[model samples]
Target: MRNSTIDLLKVLASQIIVIHHLLLYTPMSPVLQAEWPALLGLIADEGRYMVQIFLVIGGFLAAQSLLGLLGKARDVAVWPLFKKRYLRLAKPFWVAIAVAVLLGWLSSKIAMHSEISDLPTLAQLLAHVFLLHDIVGVEALSAGVWYVAIDLQLYAVLVLIAWASQKTGQLKFLEPAHALLLLASAMALASLWMWNRNAEHDEWAWYFFGAYGLGVVAHWAQRESKIVLSSLLIACVLGIAMWIEWRERLLLTGVTALLLMNSAQIERFVTLIVQGPVRWLGDISYSVFLIHYGVLVFASSVVIALGLTSVAEMLLAFVATWVVSVAAGWVLHRVVDR
Candidate 1:
């Protein structure tokens, strides 16, 4: 069966993130508040957490997929594997960066209603182009680029972790119980280190490398061993703790769910929800992630052009943004994802 739960989580996470962006277009500034802004802040903050969920899923799938490839191949070359992973992440990434930069630059100069300063400048753009900005704690050129950097890092981390596992005879032993404990200890120490570091920075790094690695650990644990509740608990606690800052909270949430092993409640609900148009959105979720902001900015401009300043027009602008952007994303995905 498909990983329906993860699919549902991906869809849910994207919607939460998009809605969060929608809120920013309005005057409901949740992050500016001291006390929690209840649903608004929670929902808006979901962009980060949802991305973490994506990371966790990506890490597990990437590693598992690579392992399968290696198992089937007699003499696996590292360069090809690395290149494959890089292309998978980097191709759409290249398009996304170019488009985001162009849109941000254009909106900054030409578009009347826009928020392009949030995007990177030339120097920052270079850092992002090289995929090294987040490494040195530099901000992204675009709003959501740190995640890109993190995804790349997690790719390398997964490779190293898998390599080490095979070399150390851990993969051969398949005594998942022992591996689970060792991983648990490692994650605990990492969490402690993060807690000691700046929470904000730690949040970003953890989401990038730490959380995804933890997911890899979980997938390995589940596949190689019977079942373990401890990993889930750890991921859960970390996720709840992450609500204060990083998006890795959502990754931790995925890990928590994965640890549950079997849950009818989640399985049935997820299957039902991911039906029809919702699943169609899942197919175009990448569009929602990449072009939604650009579409929203343009749609706002269109509303202004039409001289339709009503609340209904604002709502229409938002809906039209998703519709148009999703179509563009589908066409773009076909061309660029190759």
Candidate 2:
């Protein structure tokens, strides 16, 4: 059964991210801001941080899959898990990249927007195919692809920790799974306190592991009396990071982690909604994240081609772009993901 609250968060976050990209890539925001300044500005400025919700949710689910509902280590090989993660993330990702590249070529022939990806070179294309574009210094073929690389890296790191804890006699005081989680939490602290503060490591998993680790911890905290200790540790690390530099991402991560730990407490009315459209959107959120940039580029080109300079026309274009992104994502989810 899906947690309604988590599904609600996923649906809401995905929409915020889409709206953020729409405002960022298109010229509709200036006119919209005049009428809805706070709403537009808020979406433009703060919506991108909703990616933290994704990180948290991703980490939580990954842990559940590998570690089981009780947070115990499954007697499974890490390599199989790695392969499964790659296939799942890369399948839809490749489809989205292809869509983006095609749309990018079309956009170049018609109109140019900063958000439109140019036709990528062989090296750039291969880098993206292998999910190494950020490391190889290639410009991304689309927005939000960087998160794909980061998410894969984070999962690989967890797999390594799990494998190491089992293969070695270290952390003998706790069960092997708990020991692995402990190691992850330690690394997450280092990330929040040190590595995350440095922008040089922004492309690496460690940079985002703090929030990801919190999610993993939150999953384990369920039904455990020792969770108070884990909760305090999370609070301290996040609090100290905030004191060093106040980041909205960090604050959101802290709150999201806390909320996820208590997600079962949601009202029954909310759970009913989750089994509906919210759950559908949440299931397809990854597809939406991957392909929305391409849809945005195509929409921007149409707006430019038609000379949509009026606020009313731009508003219509904006709505159409969103609908197209979601509708296309739903189809992609069915064709590629399912």
Number of the predicted model whose lDDT against the real structure is largest: 2
Model number with the top TM-score: 2
Report clash pairs, candidate 1: 120-141
Candidate 2 residue-wise lDDT, 1-338, digit = tens: 66776888889889999999998888777778787888899899999899999899888877766566224434557788888998899999999999998988888788887777657899998998889999989999898899999999999998888777675444455666677678888988888888898989989999999989988888778535456686787888888988887777998898888778777665476787777677899888889988999988988888888888888898898998999999989988999988
Clashing pairs in 2: none
Tens digits of per-residue lDDT for model 1, 123-210: 7766766677766666654456566666766566555544444454434775333443355336534653354245565424343455
Candidate 1: Cα lDDT at 74: 30
Of candidate 2, the 10-residue stretch with the lowest lDDT total is 67-76
TM-score of each: 0.75, 0.94
Error of 1 at 81 (Å): 2.6
Model 2's C-alpha root-mean-square deviation from the true structure amounts to: 2.0
Model 1 misplacement above 4 A: 26-42, 45-47, 66-78, 105-110, 117-124, 136-139, 170-189, 192-197, 200-207, 228-256, 259-269, 303-308
Lowest summed-lDDT stretch of 10 residues in model 1?
A: 26-35
User: Looking at candidate 1, what is the lDDT of residue 88?
Assistant: 70
